[model samples]
Target: MRGPVSEGDWRGVVRDVRVTGHRVTKRATHGRDKLLREVAWLKALPPKAVGYFPRVLEVRTGEGWAEYDMDFCPWPDMSRVLVDGTLTVDEAISGTRSLLGFAFDVLYADHHRPAPEDFFHVSYVDKFWRRASAGRGMSERFDRLCSAEQLDIHGRVYPSAASLMRELQRDTVLLARLRPPCLGRFHGDFKYDNVLFEPATGRFLLLDPRGSTVTGDSDSDYMEDLAKLRTCTRGLYDLVRAGAARVSEGEGRISWEWASWAGPALQRFSALDAWLVDELSVKARARRDADWRVRLDVLMPLLLLANAPFQLAPVNPRTEDIALVLHATGVRLLAEALELHGTRDLGVSP
Candidate 1:
């Protein structure tokens, strides 16, 4: 018998997750397509050489939704570990090394050379403007905040959240130079949220991957994965998502604060990222990949810009306050990223 059709809203749950014997079933009630993507990516495993990732058991698609089941992993994901302070610095580093080993040793490949040169311009820059424009047209509040040239967030002045990206895009040639030196089959959304680490056995599992890479349906820049991880670490994404943030509007400006938190979790994450940056920087220079590091720098914040617009959408009023924090985070980081490369202003409109 057919069940009652869903409006696609989960009310609160993205899936109806349950454990049946040794298997875990994730029946999608929202964002079903996302689950489908995960299923497809997971089904195409990277072998057992690098240890664990979810093993897709079965996938089911319906009239307007999808669901899948996989091996049960009782361990906490990196996000929960970060919040609970369970994941230690050593574990973080070790787990990441193992993950990257898999990527480097197995996933690295040559599907395309040097990308399209306009990869960033097309993938990130265009999508950012399109999302922001549509988002601003959704609400006057979003319109005002998104339309502003400069914003004072946490008492710090930043260029508009979406504008700096446009500024970077103003000079297409420069955007063309932002490609990472190495291209490979990538875990498009590689971040803490997608990683599950078990401290006891020292085994980690990655769940939920984008169906394909950013630049294509097959391969992508390796730095894209690194940038996504940096978003959680140096970008304080986990901190901000944990409600360790404040946002308010007044005096014709919006203010967003990545407020204080007690503990070593955030600090530990920052350290991990710092280590990654230092290590990668040396190798980038050795390869004479002038744009490699800069591309990574730019990608870190472009990731935020890629998703910030969804927060601005009027779909759920509950996520409204989060919009500003996301906006400011991207803007501030984009400015800093551009500065690191000595990238000059392209005279993009305020």
Candidate 2:
């Protein structure tokens, strides 16, 4: 039997034993009350969803524990595939493209005009802003980093987080002009481990859709998977390793270890993303293409910013410093991306 695996929000206790002769059981639990909500949503999925997720065999709820049993998926976990070094660039690109394409097709198959609330559900932005601005040390470091007039952020210079934030907000406004006519259904959580791929069938099984429903905010769901995918695949593990090192060294200052490890991965991810966006633009039209590009530009930074805290908060004390550095990195990336095209788009330079 596999021991418990803990991520940010939930701990999954997996049992290798079968419910009958062939069915394995997994008991997923959360320290908070969220597990039951996820269970409820999993149980309520329409039959069509079974093709993209595991089949739920049973469910139970109690005071401090929530659990569910599902057929053990035989497909390979995508994260393991990546970690094992067997994941090719083509495979990574295909897997994400196929899975996201399928989700969009299913969710938008019968779409009409987007719900009115979709246009205004910018809560994701606000949520990330709150988290990114919350850590004093990280903010202080970010302030220090930005104080350098020569601080090169991907070839652009940001004088301060304030200037960066202003540029990001400005880009947000520009990208807002090219929204899709209607909001469609999307996977709220599409991390790699949450996705299972069957090589033989060229199909993907998506797990753990956000169990909660948001009225009129479906637009936020768009490309949410891509944002998370880029984060996890590109930098999360490096940040984790960096944090572990910082803890071991007992220093919170920025170190070469982070850049040494995460730098290449981040670069690779950027190239991959550019390739994907280009491929998608050719397949979709100009408007849809622009929306996806904008999502990569604006929405991804927000997602990364919001996730920085969640990633850092649950670790032991030693790792807190690492988390702070990681958080600062996310903010730095956000600022850099916001200023990528410079202020020419806004008719001014900062």
TM-score of each: 0.83, 0.69
lDDT of 2 by residue, 208-271 (tens): 6655322223334455556666666544543353332342221222443433544544554556
Model 2 root-mean-square deviation: 7.1
Go through the candidates in order and give each one's C-alpha lDDT: 0.67, 0.51
Clashes of each: 0, 1
Q: Please give the lDDT score at residue 306 for candidate 2.
A: 56
Task: Summarize candidate 1's per-residue lDDT along 1-350 as a digit string, tens digits.
Answer: 11232222312335667889989888875677557756766766656423456777788889766878888887887887876677788887777777666655555543345666656666676656655655655555656666777776656666776567656766555566786565556777788888887776667777666756433345577778878888887777776667666677864366655456535666787778887777667655655668777778788887876666565434444355565566667777888876656447623223
Global CA lDDT computed for model 1: 0.67
10 residues in a row with least lDDT, candidate 2: 1-10
